[model samples]
Each structure stands twice: as C-alpha cells, then as structure tokens.
Target: MEFFGMNKRKIIAIADPYSTGHHLSYNKLLVEAARRNDFKVVYISDRIGCKYINEIFPDTDIFINEIGISNSKISREVKKIVFYIRAFQYCRRRDIACLHIAYIDRSIFSIALANSAIKIDKLLITLHWNYFSSPENNSLINRLETKIFSWLSRGSVNTNVHSGLIVDDLYIHNIKSKYTPYPIAVLPSITSHEENKLSCDGEIDALVTLIRKADVSLLCFGGMRYDKGADLAVHLLESLPEYTHLFIVGKPEYFSKEYLNNLAMSLGVESRMHVYDQYIADDDIQSIFNACSIVCLPYRESFSGQSGPLTIAASLGKPILASNNRFIAFEINNQSIGEVFDSLSFHEVNRAFIKALEKSYSPKEFIEKHDPERFIESIGEMYKVNND
Candidate 1:
C-alpha cells in the first residue's frame, strides 16, 4: 500500500559517528527514501556528514553538533554523545513515531541509557554484522558490545540487517532481524541506456587520465582495510596482464601506502598500479566509477556487512568481480551482474578477473525485492505492527 497522510510522522536517522565520505552517500539516500515515502526525516549526523548531506539534500531537516569539530574517533564520539542527549530531549518534547539508528553499535549505550528516561513507539537498529561464527568477533570487548546491543535490540520493534544470512545468525542468538537490502547510493541521471556509456574523451580528466592509459581499470573503492582485500587486489596485479591497471582508492585504514608500494615493487607490478591513499571526493566517485571497466570486491569472509561498493557499481551499471562470501555470491548470482571467485583461492580470483575483463555488462534489474521503497514500506509495516 502507498504511504499517504503520514507526512507529520517523524523518522529520525542518527548516523554512525564514524561514517566516512562513502557511507554518507547511502545515508543521504536513506533520508531521501524516507521523505519520498511521506515521512519527515530528522537527520542527525556529525558536522562533516551534515555538510555533505546539506549539499545533496538541502530540504530535509538536519541537526548536528555546533562545535563542528574535525573528523576523528574521539571527536566523533564526543559529538555523538552530545547529539544523543539533544536527540532524546527533542524526542521527549515531540512524539517521534520511530527512531532509526545507523551504525547502531556506536549508539547502543546512548540508547540503553536513554531507555529508562523516555520511551518511543518504535525503535530500529541497523546491525551491519553479527559474525558469531568468527572467533575474533567473540573477544571480551566485542562480546560485551554485542551483549549490550543485543539487549537493546530486544526492546526494538525491528533490527535491520543487509542479508538473510545475518538475520538467521541473529535468530540463532534469539534476536530477530529484518532483511533490508542496501539501497542504490547513486541514481544515474540518464535514463537512456545509450546515454550511460562512458566516453573515452569525457572532460573528467582526473579519471580519464588513468582510464585512457589502461586497457582495464580495476577499481577497489572504500576503506583500505586488510579485510577489504586491497592487498589481494595488488597481489593479483603481480601476474595480471600488463594492460590491466589496479586502482586502489580510499583512505588507508590499516594498509599503509609505503607498504603497499613496496609490496607492489617487489612483485614487479608497481608501475601498473595507482594507489590514491586519501579520501576520495564525492564528485570523483562517479569519475572513478566511469573510468573503470569493472569494479573489484575481493572482500574476505571477515567482513559480514553489505557491500556499498557493490551497490554503487550496480547503480552505475558496472560489472563486479567479487568474492564468494554468501551475500556477494547471492547478489552476483541473483542479479547476474558479475562473477564470484573463491575468496580463499587466488586461482579463482584470477579466473574471475579475467572473465570480468573479457565481458562488461550491467545487471538486468536492481534487487527490487529489497530496494529502498520496499525497505521503507517494510519499516512502515513494522511501525504498524508495534503501534497496533
């Protein structure tokens, strides 16, 4: 059913304190999706995210800390602590129909603390992953965090997760979750298929400069964490054809540029790679996507959340070369968008890379079953379930 006469109902989206530039894109999409469904969104985020969102979504209601501090772990946490106190106050003064927390782990303590002070009709938490199978994920700190978040979730109307596997995992732990697919972050402006083609001579020099030089531009976007397989992408370059160039984009989280370069040099493929070890600007995101023949996501099993890069790639109609993680595998097979390799086997990775390079195509359709509209509708259903 269409959402109508619900414009006054408040849906607040509290962003993750540690959200990076890449994540803000999807966060904006979330706000837009909610507004499109006739609900007014009260977007609460860090100063950086607020600025970015203001530029993209000026009409939405927004609130951020006044200090406007720099992006750092301590600063973000401090800002969020302040934001949460203010948020609870705002909710207390007004009847908020629902509260949606992004990066829910970061705000669990705040929510738990506020629960005794105030109550709301519906509470929704986005659990990126609950990797109960991984021993590393069961450390004392992680365990404590999980218990707190799980306990808070027990009171929530619905816990949102990216894949059914995650829902099943949460089920084993007795916390029910809803499978909400990650939304398409970037919507192509051009509807005609012919207009979407990337011209080799486009004026986007930063991207074109590299795309024009290589036969295949293999893009690895987002944080350069070891779990993200940046090194694996570099390792593939050691034996890849000289025509293929690996572009590892995003800020270095764990892997340093000097280390990556040295490894590439030792493998004798340093000349065929470009490592932009900084946060990519928003406009440059599409440039990088346009310049590449295909997107690569060799993420390790350690990563259990949805792949934002995969969503972005699908949005731009670019093919993906992903690992065999259940979510990635399901998306690749479900949409016929790309090929999946055995993440553990370099041999399979190489084969998938070759296949991706040999053919470039887009998915037949978006994962409509889990698209944003349906996601909002699901949340609406949950709201009704709780309010009834």
Candidate 2:
C-alpha cells in the first residue's frame, strides 16, 4: 500500500466486532505498535469502534472500516460470515500482508468455512478463552468447532493466547501457538479534582464518593454475568464486616440493578453495597479503582482464562480477591499479588476476602512483567517475523 509518496509493504489488518470493554484500549495498543513498526493498519470494527480509532489517532496512516453486524445472535452470525468474506476480499484487493483476528470465538465457523476460498499471506487469531480446558465444553457443536479450529491452527494460521497454560494445552493438541502477556492500558493517575472534572456529569463522582466512605471497599468491575459470579459478590458482602463495602461497576448483563439491590436488601447488606449499572469510560477507570481498597474477580470454575480486570488491578498496585481460575490463580501466586478463593464456596470466598484485605501487596514485579512496551514489542515482532 502506498501512503503519501512512500510504499509500505508490511500491512496488518486487525478485525474485532465490539468496540466497548477492553476492545477500545486493546485495539489502540495494536495500532500504536503497528505505527511504531512502520506497518500500515486496516482496523475493522463496528461503527462506534471506527469512530473511536479515528478520533484517537487522527494523524496516523491507519484505515478504519465498519463491519456492519447487528446485535442479534443469529443475525450476527450471518453478518459475520458475509463480513469475513468481504474482509478477505478487501485484504486481497489492498495487498494486505497479514490479517489478525482479535477475537476468534464468534468467527471460528465463518473463518473455517471461508478458509479454502480466501487467501492471505499470514493469519493470526487471539484465543481469549481456552475452550479445551473444560470437559463441559464437550458438546457436539463445540467439538466440531474444535476440530475445525485445530485444522486451521495446523495450517498457516498462528494462534496467540494470553495464558501460558493455554499454550501448553494447545501444544498437546499439536496446534501452533504463542503466549503474549495481555496488554494493560496505562491509565493516567487522576487526583480528586481531576477525577471530579472528568466524571460523567457527576455520576462517577457520586459513585466514587460513596465507595470512599467505606473503610475498605471491594470493587467487582466489568460485565455482570452469571459466569463472572456477580451474585457471589453480593453474597460475600453478608459475611464481611458492615464497614467493608462492595462496588459493582459495568453494565449488568445477566442481573439487573433492581435484582442485585433486592438481593442485597434481602441479605441485609444493602446499606454497604453500591451498584453502578452503566458503562464506565476509560478516563474514569483509574479513579474508580483508586476509590476502592481491592478489586474482586469472582469468576466461576468454567472461566479458565485470563482477566482484564486482574491486570488492571495489578497495574495500579491494588490487591485482588479472585477465584481460582487456572490462569488467574497462577498469576496471583506466581506474582505474589493477591489472594485466590473457591468461587463456588461462600465460606472460602469470605475467608480469602478477609485475608486479602489484611495482606500487604507489592505489585512492582507484576507491573514490570506486564509492561505495555514489552507487549507491544512482542506483537510487533510477531508481525515482522510473519511478514519476512
């Protein structure tokens, strides 16, 4: 591809469907790395994602496209098939050297079906979850997808996973894979005045104020889903001291605000629980984390994968109270960052919660291990090696 008067042959195309949550920061990191390595990027995402990228890096030679996929499950699947077909066509037309799929779960079937029809120099997939880690995922459909994905991995496609445990699992299956530390966005430290100024019209400020009122607050950030053990977080509040509060942030996916509040009220811990059932912007993240004493990740046993919040908490030097997921438990124990609990057992969670509050943590080692520059360099090297 030619930009201005210069021809840049190393072109990487990154495609992610959703723009919210970690995608915004993760995509921005990839774009930054691509720019630093002199590789032109074609970022494909939903309309909001395209706008977000254009606004952040206005001067960079990056091409952004809107992948028109609706929110409905069936509609999204059909649209994804069409989108991948068109995306590959665009890649070929532009002579894009590499196509990296940021999330591979939803598009596995589409890509497998389109594998023979489309051609690209290099294809990379980031596996966010280790589907093969659990026997519960032995459903027929999952098995079929696993077979297809394994076939794809055995070919020209290279898989990128955040967990070393996942890499070992893939190795046993004879799939080519590499481990890259999950990129954590470096959020600027905001003082009380700056935080109040950056709040979403006083909403976040009010939440922060309420959380700070507690002597020690536990924050459960991100989507409130069943697998994430949102209910367990509320339950744990019953066992802790009254002054030890719990803050639930992020949009509620499986449980509503009223449901959680009613649950808390029924358990007699309503006074100590704060729930912000809305999406929190990136600028406001550090302020919320700062307001709380610890970050809680009560994910269930089925979720044997890495967590964005875990890394976020580590970066800010906040102690964590997380479930014993394979990757999360390993990170906490290996880095000496925080405590792990049995998510299914209330007694264990409460015990671990108290211990985590009392324990002094030093996240200097964790921060150094997951430095953003190291992640960026690894990703850049992956693309450079593939291109060569």
Candidate 3:
C-alpha cells in the first residue's frame, strides 16, 4: 500500500554497544534514507557521548552501555549488570516505544527490564543466524535465558504489534524461537556515497602500486572472527597461487598479524598477500570502497540476515563473491552482484573466483535494485500503521 496524505513519524533505533567500529555503518545509511523520506531518525549508543545522545535523540531516546568495563571482573556476570541497568534507565527516561536489539543477550535483558519497568510497545529483535543449526547459543544457562526471553518476546509482540528480525530463518532445527536459537526477521545494513564518484589519484596509485609491487587482487572485508571464514578464505587462496593478492581489511578477533603472516608464509603466498589490520575510520571509507574491485565474504552460515559489506558492495556497485548458503543469496542472485562459491572445497571457490574476476557491475542497476528509498517507505508505513 502506498502512503498518502500523512506526516512522517519519528523513528528511533536502539543499537547494541559492542566496543566500537564502523561495522554498524550500514545503520547510518538506513537513518539517512529514513530522514530523506521525512521520518526523524534517532540513534542511540552509550559509547558515543551526551552530545551524540542529544544529537541522535532529542525526545524519546534509547541506549545501552556495554563497553569501558574490563572483562577481568570477579565474574562475567558483573559486566552484564551494568549493561542491563543502563539500558533500562534509558528506556524509562525516554518512554520508548520499542527496543531494537542487536543480539540475543541484549534482547533478553533489555526486554526483561523494560517490561518490568513500563509499558513499552513494539519490542522487536534481530537474530544473527539461520535456523540451520550451528554451534550457536545452546549453552545450559543460555537455554534458560532463551526460554525466558522468548516468553517475553511473545508477550511483547502481543502488546506492541511492531517487531522485526533482519532475516526469518527459524525452524532449521524445529526448535521454537522463544530462546537463543530462534530465527528473527532480516534488517540488513547499508552502504552509500555520492553519485558519479570516480577513482581519485591517490586511490589509483595505491591499487596500481599493489598490482605492480605485490600480487594482491582480492579483498576480504570485516573482522577475522572464527565464523567469519577468514582462515577458510586464506586456505582457499593458498590453493590459488596464481591469484597473488588477497588484501584483508580489518583486525582479527583471535589471531594476531604474526599468526596470519605465518599462515600466508606457510601457504607460500606471503609475498603476494597483504594485511591492513589497522582501524579504518568513517571518513576513509569511500576511498577504501573505491580501492577494491570486489568484496568477498565466504561464510559457513548467513549473518542471520545482515550483510554490511555485501550491502555496501551492492550500493557501491562492486562485484561480491560470497558463499551461497548465506541469506543474502536469496536477494543478490546474479552475476553482476557476484556469485556464491562452495564453502567446503577449495576447487569450487577457485572456479567461482575466476568467474567473479571476469565480472563487474553497474552502480545504476545496483542502486535501483537495492536502494534504501523503497525500504524507508516501507518502514515509514510500518511506523505509522504498526500501532494504529
């Protein structure tokens, strides 16, 4: 249904505070798009200051504090104590309509606390996994937490009418979502920039220099976490000795530079591969996006349904060679957007990489397909009609 004869409502986003990074930069695109469509966007996070709080949310606000405290406390429980208290206080002060959770724990505690304190409507949550069953949240205490959380979610949904998950891939194991492993709807991240942007002199020099001096031709963007498939990509690239460069942007969750270097050296591609594990700020992003021709994410599972890099590539109109199993494959099912490779075999990936290298995409077509205009319109519809 098209929206007509109406005013855009205020839309607030409650994000999870996981240390800091532009990793959540996708949300910025959503906020911009929403505002352009006439909805007020209010973003909240405790990592940013009171200035940010004031800037993001002048009236009804939402925030959480999960950083600053060392994990070296008497118990892991101590850290959570602070997070819940801060989140609850923020909700109470703002008269929040909904709590948009970034993770399961954040949902469980914040919803539990919010429900305890006041009448919060539209309590929606996002899940980070497909119901396809992996080594995801099945710990004993986590199970108990999930059961309680699901109970709260059902209650909230009944009351509020507004809720979402980035992707809805529950029922993979026949387990209900009242707990940690349940599927949430998809709410993807985005990446955007000005139009008609061509490669700058310095960016051209950097890519040319890499091509001339080093053998790097590929880029794996994002944290080198275990599930993120960094080592797997490394292994696959090791087999493709002809493909000289696999430039990894971002730091590793566990392995250090020395360890990754050793892996490259052992694979005999150390001379060709490069690792820029330093922090890449928001201002440097446009150049970074322009530097690479393709963005590769070969994960064993989907990001529940969020893909910051994938969405960025789609927006920037760069080809993406990703794993077929992820939820994004359903949306980005074409060569220009990039194709999926086998997560199991190096041979499968080698062929996929060859095809991906042969292909490129048009920015115009990508923006038309995945532009935030339609989504913001849809979200605006939901915002106005969800509670009514």
Candidate 4:
C-alpha cells in the first residue's frame, strides 16, 4: 500500500466527531487521499466509526476514541477541556507530524486551546460554516474563539473550507483558507457488510415502486432536520400537479415519519407522499435517486454549510431545486445544474420546482470538473507533511 519514493515523514492523523451520515464517505475519501499522497494516516473517531473504517480499509491502522462533546452547556465545556488535554497528549505520544481535524464547528474553542499547546509539525482544520454570518455568532465568547482559530491558522496550522463564500468570509477577517471541493460520496462497487443488512428490506422496493408510479417524483434525501425543511417539501406537494409525488429518504433528527405524514395528510397529499426513515446503504442510493425527477433542498437560513444531498444529486445528474444558501445557490447557478429559490417563500419554491421539472440540465460538465480524483488531490496537497 506504500507509494514508492513518497515522503515518509511522521504519520498524519485525521480526527472526526461523528461516524454516521456524510462522515463515513468523507472519512473514507480522506484516508484514500492520504494513502495516495504517501502519508501514513492514523484515523481517529468513535468506536462505531473506527469499526466502519476498519471494514472499509482493513489494512490501515486506526484509533478508536470519542472526539465529540455532549450537548448540555456545562457538560459540553467540561468535555471540550478534557478532549483538548487528551488530544495534545495523543499527538505528542504518537509523534504525529500533522493533525487534521475534519469537522471543527462544535470543538473550535477546544481545538484552539489544543493548537496552542500541541507540538505537532502541522495542524489542519476544515472550517465547514461561516460563523460570522450573524451578530449572535460574533458574541464575546465566539469572537474570542474565532480570534484564536484565526491566529493559529497563521502558524503551522492550515485551514480549508468547502464553500467559496466561507473562504471569502475568512479572507475578509484576515484569515487565509483554501477552497476544497466537497468530496463526492462514491457508492462502493462491492456492497459492504453493513449494506448487506438492507438487501432484504422490502421498504427499498416499495419506495422505488411508489416513485416510479408517479409522473414526477421529488426527493428530499439525507438526514432530515427541521432546518432541512421537510415541511416545506410537503407543502410543495399540495400545490404541484396531482401526479407529482414526494419521497423522503434518510433518518429524521428532531421529528418522526408520522409527523411528516401528518403534515402531508393535512395538505391532502398523503396518497402521493412516501417516507423511509432509516439510514440507507450505498447500494440503495443510486436506485433511490434514479427514481426521483428532482432533488429538493429547502434548508433554512440558519444552515450555512454545504449540503451532502446537493453533492449527491449533482453527481448523480439529478437536477436540484435548492434554497438560495450562499454555497448551494452558487453551485446551481454557476454550473447551470438546476434552479434556486428563497426557502422562506412558499410561492417562489413552488414556482421554481415546476420550472426545474421543465428545464433540461446538462450536469456532465459540472460532474467532470468536480470529480472525486480532483477532490482527493486537493486534500492530498493539504495533507503534505513537508509544507515548508
């Protein structure tokens, strides 16, 4: 697995908080990139995430550790302090040349603390959101955290973000960052042991059948949250043509399938709506996306990060109908991939969805520009141990 003549410096470690959702695919892509760049990677995540990584790359070394904090204010602060102490110690003991944190939103302050004390050769962080978007985010405590994070970035620490808008925002604050493409979640060619569990799940076939029966099926894929606007998707169904259907795939975070169904029932579109409230396997992603006419993303204004479902939809050549979030709108408009509308306006979204259905999209050019190899190479450059 070693690349000949590749710089054999100290190992590069990647730390991620969560194991589920886009984390699994993102971590896999990162590990592959590190290996390709000739860096020995020590993957660190929770026990479940570690096991999943092991199953994917059995030969690669991995470390099982909890990297996320609790939700409670007091408990979260306490856990962050402990995590910072332990992280610094682990890097010192392992002689880690570079420590790249995959997601630093929740643990930014703790990571800032660790950066000050850790003696690693280099540190890398992926800034996923624009924290300075609101006055609340600029509160005294948050400003302090941002200052520390930016100060550290000028040293051995390198920072990157998936959105160009985030990069620009960081630049405005005198923080330099690289714009890395969000890695496409390539479904595995060979089904994994976990995916095999869903082989006999009748829900997959039922959903596919339901979508195929419709004239035009709208899909809201990936983890469901109130911010993601599943309620808006339901509302759109009521105004669309009678033949239009909606399929919601992925696990719900703060709501239940019954709640969404009830909303659809209230809108009198219950007969045309379908819900699959569970984690979908890699094998099923293609079939599900293929069944849908358009991918809907009506995320609220509070959501400032890139959408995993948007990436998936674009890669699959499925046209998107996304909210006018800075990143999502940029991608759709820049690439001519689909249509965009303000998430707050029900009438706008309704009109935009119909327009998307009628318009033809040629995402092949967009797909070619942001392929997985390009994303991997960008990350590999960031993971370079000898950046001097």
Candidate ordering by TM-score (highest first)? 2, 4, 1, 3
Question: Candidate 1 — worst ten consecutive residues by lDDT sum?
Answer: 184-193
- In candidate 3, what are the lDDT values of residues 1-388, reduced to their tens digit? 1123433224444455553565244344435444554554445555553234445536423344544556564444455555655654564455545455444433455456655665456554545433223235466755655555456656544221111232132333333433322211122322345532444467444744563454436677776766667766677676564745777777666555677788888977777667766655445555666567567787656244456667567677677777775455654575257877756476877777777767767666655545555555544444444434
Which candidate ranks first by lDDT, i.e. highest?
2
Per-model TM-score, in order, reads 0.80, 0.90, 0.72, 0.86
Model 2 spans > 4 angstroms off:
1-8, 59-71, 132-136, 177-200, 343-347
lDDT minimum window of 10 residues, candidate 3? 158-167
Error of 2 at 150 (Å): 0.5
Compared with the true structure, all predictions reach lDDT values of 0.66, 0.76, 0.53, 0.73
Candidate 4 clashes between residue pairs 3 or more apart in a chain or in different chains: none
lDDT for each residue of candidate 2 in 1-388, tens digit (9 for 90 to 100): 3444434356788887778787878778778777788887887777788788878877543344455647788887887787677777777777676888888865788877666688777888888887653445677877777777778786568787777777776666555544454544343232122443544558888998888888999999998878788888898887777778899999989988999999999999998888899988778787888789989987876675678788778877788998787677888898888899865476887788788888888666776667777778888877777777
Estimate, for each residue in 1-388, the C-alpha lDDT of model 1 and write its tens digit: 1224543254454444545655675566567656565566666666777787777767666667453554887776666666666666665455566767666645566666665466666666676765542334676756666666666766544676666666666656565444454333333322222333444334345655776568888888888887788988888776566788988888898898888899899889998888878776555566677678879898877777677778767766788988787767877787777888875465776788788767756544664543555555555554444444
lDDT-better candidate, 1 vs 2: 2
lDDT for 170 in candidate 4 is 68
TM-score: the better of candidates 3 and 4:
4
Lowest-sum lDDT 10-residue window in model 4? 188-197
